[model samples]
Target chain A: MGLPRKDRIRAKLKSENTTVRVLLAHPMHTGRAKDEADTLIPAEFIQDIRCWRNDEEVLTIKCGTATARNPYFSFQLVGGKQGDMITIRWVDNRGAKGTTETVVK
Target chain B: MTDDIMQQRRAILKGAISASTLALVAASGLLLPRQLLAHWPKNAFNAETVEDALLALLGEADIADDAALNFKVGSPPSYAINGASVPIQIQSDLNNIERIAVLVENNPFPLAMSLELTPAVSLPIKSMIKIREDSPVIAIIRAEGKLYKTSRFVEVDIGGCG
Candidate 1:
């Protein structure tokens, strides 16, 4: 919940001068079931995912309920050069946070 | 004649009622609690360290097989497995990679990984991940030249929230 997905994406892209892809792991449960304690774990999941390089956003995804246990995403960052960074981040319905970073080389 | 007719009618109704009651009991008997508990895990998949995870993936061969291609994980994991959404990536700089496999150490299944890249794939892939606990993540890449391996350790504070 603390890391930024954009930074994660950027970190991967920065590894080489090419397109970078990322997938965020999220159970994306629909909150349709009760736990062993008979408590309802309300549906909380990533609602949107965005990736950026420098100041420009490379990929923006609006996720919905149909996504599976862990949502996987792939995208391309144009003009990746050495020392550049790509960042990817997502916000869930409950407003939780998760992010990753990749360096372009 | 009225009394005799009433007795026969009563006997038929009793038989029908018994038959239906037995059927209901039989159906309920099959739906037991023990049968439903089969899915619960006795232990949340636990492996002590990253090297242990790699050994589990390799399965007794123990020998380092450089012929096996490998993908490297970033120095630190991307996210905490708050809900098993820890991000991971794999890239192969090898020239003859034909297949790639990922294994999460502390998941319910140690072999909880998959990647089959054709020649068309650029010998690298990256994805987010779900980890049950802190453990090493292993990547097994195979190329025509040989087999190579890569691994990384992730520090997970919380598991996949059971």
Candidate 2:
């Protein structure tokens, strides 16, 4: 299932730091699940995540199959102010990619 | 009868050629993107031991214990019904912290997750991870180019790894 890019990112500015939280929509199939026909579902998950603030990279997360479905990531960005641009992007094992940008609030 | 047989042979040949062409296209389509975008740490994730994983990913496993790091792990349930998705939070007060990695010592693949942080980002990050069995979850933080580490043992009732 695919979701609108903007819906995945949530960011709020608290004081000088902005807390950016992302909820990626993915099945995160661990390659261990069996379908009703008893067939294994090959693993599919977001393998890499990169976050940027105003074109400067802030965080890079290397994820594995152990990460939960519709993974949630929360981190802080220091020295961010209102209306600062924050962009988050991710790529899954299937080579699917998603990116979203939001202004710091 | 001879003409009918020839027609059937041509049809079969056409089908085979198209099938092979489709298969080749599909295989390349599936492979090209993975090779281009793949950046996951396969060596670290597939490492048999935590030390190997750490060495592969961080180039070292000899992390020192520093009391000033203020490393803290948010508590997880003592007995987890489903170890597949256990919520965990890691935070450190150490300044200039560059990276944080989570490792479950007893899992088949011990390296669970790692986050590289820029100076503009804050210290503590929260996420969910899987645990195979009862094991110590190590949180290693890189601060000022030095590796400092700590651990918390979590008792898992059901193993997550297959």
Candidate 3:
């Protein structure tokens, strides 16, 4: 239940802003599902996500178990230029973490 | 004299306006302690019911049905995720958007995600959420120190994505 997941991040320069999309691979277990053995799986979902633009923290996302598996999120970042670095870090309820980074292009 | 009545009405209106202003000041005052000790808002996300979730997150605040805070779910059946993931696109013309959240009324865990964006982030967000069945998906936005919401019913044809 405390397994780490993979992350994919993409940041692109748009008209007036840079759009960033992040995809996280997680089971997002709700503690309600059962395996073939019929045991409840522990809830293991992302609880906190922090987005960073270079050194400054840009935003924080609070997510629950209801977020889909392999969650995808996209947002537009203003004043972003090509080659700027964007980073995403997340921690799930099980204390597992995933971090992804990309350069605006 | 009718002039006396007009004066009284104006005085009452002025008092009402000041009262509302004071109330606004007091409300923002409550946020100071919260910001000082901000966390993941566990009570809100843990709430099972929509009313409880809203109350826990935003307090007993007024919510306006805003048409400007619009959200679209995939309808071309391609957006019709046969599984748990349902894509949603949200765009808002409202100003001063401090926070945005998505909730599915029927999900066992209602609050899917909440975003705290800085001025650097613009609107027209696209995201995915887990929906088990047919339910109303509500997007709540905090803009201009007020809460605005718009909702749409999403039908999930299949079950868990796991």
Candidate 4:
């Protein structure tokens, strides 16, 4: 609700042997300092990640501030045909959520 | 065998061994490129919010939660660095992902960390960035062409820049 923005993944179907790449956008903000007006900006960042293909869970991860911004990723799958779909989702420290999709051909 | 015959046999064996080794190395090249760039999320930059930073980093079409992406973070940081190292991490269980991102809740600039993934490897991203004061940390991911988000609140121990 009042959490920060989140991201998701999507894709088109492709050949069973074809592989795909994905990268989500986020900030690994470390709560540290204040602003010009003497205001404090709290620390916020990502904590976990998960993905699926054709309604089947495939991968999962647990991360923290040590990570960089807009993390990048790539993976492969078998038995995929053109026009198929790929989906991804993630959550951030603020409870914010985001979703996205893609089509492989 | 005679002296001449022995020398010829040694020469032939050496040539055969060298040729076979070279061929083997070349054959392996076919699968090398895919293995190199097949991973995702290689670059990272800072931003102020989840929406602005993500759009600047991942692109428009690659976002979805039905993708079932998930993430977590610390309840609230109990310390501060006056704009120094802020510990944090973002992890995704999605097998088809290549990158992840993090952001700050109240920072003048939010977007913080991002990481790229490689096949046959787990895509867990972590890092610490500068923060102003008390705020929440946000985490996001783009796996298999979808996106997801999460956040955590942190309390500063010492006040510096603030």
Estimate every model's Cα lDDT from 0 to 1. Answer: 0.54, 0.78, 0.83, 0.54
lDDT string for model 2 (B112-143, tens) is: 78888778888568887777788887888888
TM-score of chain A of 2: 0.90
Per-residue lDDT of A20-47 in model 1, one digit per residue for the tens? 6565666665465468998877876666
For all predicted structures, in order, the TM-scores are 0.42, 0.77, 0.82, 0.39
Measured against the true two-chain complex, the DockQ scores of the candidates, in the order shown, are: 0.07, 0.47, 0.55, 0.06
Give the share of true interchain contacts found in each model.
0.03, 0.75, 0.86, 0.06
Tell me the lDDT of candidate 1: 0.54
User: What digit string (tens of lDDT, one per residue) describes model 3 on residues A20-54?
Assistant: 99988787787888888988888888888889999
lDDT for each residue of candidate 2 in A4-104, tens digit (9 for 90 to 100): 34437878988777899888777777787688889998888788988889878778898877776678888888877888888988888889988888888
Instruction: List per-candidate RMSD values in Å.
Output: 14.9, 10.8, 11.1, 15.2
Model 1 misplaced regions, further than 4 Å: A1-68, A73-105, B1-83
Docking class of 4: incorrect
Clashing pairs in 3: none
lDDT of 4 at A16: 38
**What's the ranking of the predictions by TM-score, best on top?**
3, 2, 1, 4
**Model 4: residues with Cα > 4 Å off, grouped in runs:** A1-105, B1-48, B61-83, B159-162
Badly placed stretches (over 4 Å) of model 2 are A1-7, B1-38, B69-79
| Candidate 2: Cα lDDT at A57 | 77
Q: Which candidate is the best by TM-score?
A: 3
Poorest stretch of ten by lDDT in candidate 4 chain A? A1-10
Model 3 misses residue B148 by how many Å? 0.8
